[model samples]
Target: MIKKIKKLKKIRLHREGTDTLVYGFIVIAAIALLLWRFIDSKVPFWCFTAIMGTVYCIVINFFRCPIRFFPEEDTTGLVVAPADGRVVVIEEVDEDVYFHERRIMVSIFMSLFNVHANWFPVDGKVKTVAHHDGNFHKAWLPKASEENEHADVVITTPEGTDILCRQIAGAVARRIVTYAKQGEDCYIDEHLGFIKFGSRVDVYLPLGTEICIKMGQLTTGNGTIIAKLK
Candidate 1:
């Protein structure tokens, strides 16, 4: 019960951001101290301090990794969202790179303020994890799905359904971290990876899969159902 209660907390700092937050705080503190000692004008010191403090607050918010899980006990045939953001796309596209056929693509675009941590979208065994080096495009654009640097994790469900989860780097994002390993089992509650800064996640479902989300709708990672596999 105690663990569950803690998991239900509103906010928690992710370990991935520990170094960043600690270093940011130190750097900001040093700058503020320098200003206070060297500058005679109190107004400029306070103004600089206030601005930098707010900027660090925004960075803290960006690194937040809220504990989340699908509320239901049964997860069979259900595909949960992998990241928190707005559903920027829901369309059927030809996925030539992996599937070599048509698939339904559902994309969630995370802004700098959203949690950068990613979660496994399904309960399955990871088929493979692939990372591609490419240009960083704006994540919301369609071309970003292919042109942007991304990490792909493919999982085969217990029922033998294959799903592709891709994490795309955005214009501001430089790193894509993927934790899912080949042949490893993954669950909806387990984190798949973390993307630094702004980015997006794309889930490719097999043709005929029923999508539960709509374009422009906000989705909570590990909580919102992305689709129902047939």
Candidate 2:
């Protein structure tokens, strides 16, 4: 059990091997170039410049990456925010593909510095998981939620009520990772997946669910109460 907990925390760390590899490659290449220059021309200035530049890039990327997760308690009848970001939009939107009807849409915009992990909004069984190929637009752009490349995961709680959560790619985000699949048992606060860098998450709630958050409000994934079950 302790090992599992440690593994979970490790997964939540945003800077994995990919970030390390990228940073290492740039730093190593810069160092190598500087060494060659110093060996051939006795120019020590180039080495310092390369090392500083590489360090700066590594620091910026490491600090800006975001990681998040959801609560583990049963969230039946409650609507939890899926990502950490500012609430950008809340309106009635037609969602024909999954809900097959008009639903209340709550869109959260995640900046590059915000946590990019997505969480299950309710304790339930994964009813459907769909991925759509589309364009990558600015995350806060009005149409990005509907038009950008995204993946939708719908969960049906014990009461048989449906909750839809989507991870949408932003201008800076190129990939959406999801772990939930249809019929999979998922608990509230489970780490469903993550969005690389900046992105947005659109949560579709049943009409009449009281939205506790307003536009511009900052929320934490797995921690914030987005709305109460009606």
The deviation in Å at residue 7 for candidate 1 is 5.7
Tell me which residue pairs clash in candidate 2: 70-189, 70-222, 71-189
What is the lDDT of every predicted structure here?
Answer: 0.91, 0.76
Candidate 1 to truth, TM: 0.95
Strongest candidate by TM-score:
1
Minimal lDDT window, size 10, model 1:
1-10
* Candidate 2 overall lDDT versus native: 0.76
18 Cα displacement, candidate 2 (Å): 3.3
> Which pairs of residues clash in candidate 1, taking residues 3 or more apart in a chain or in different chains?
none
Query: Residue by residue across 3-54, what tens digits does model 1's lDDT show?
Result: 1212453568988899999999999899889989998988878998899989
135-190: candidate 2 lDDT, tens digit per residue: 99898887887789999998887787888898999888898889898888886556
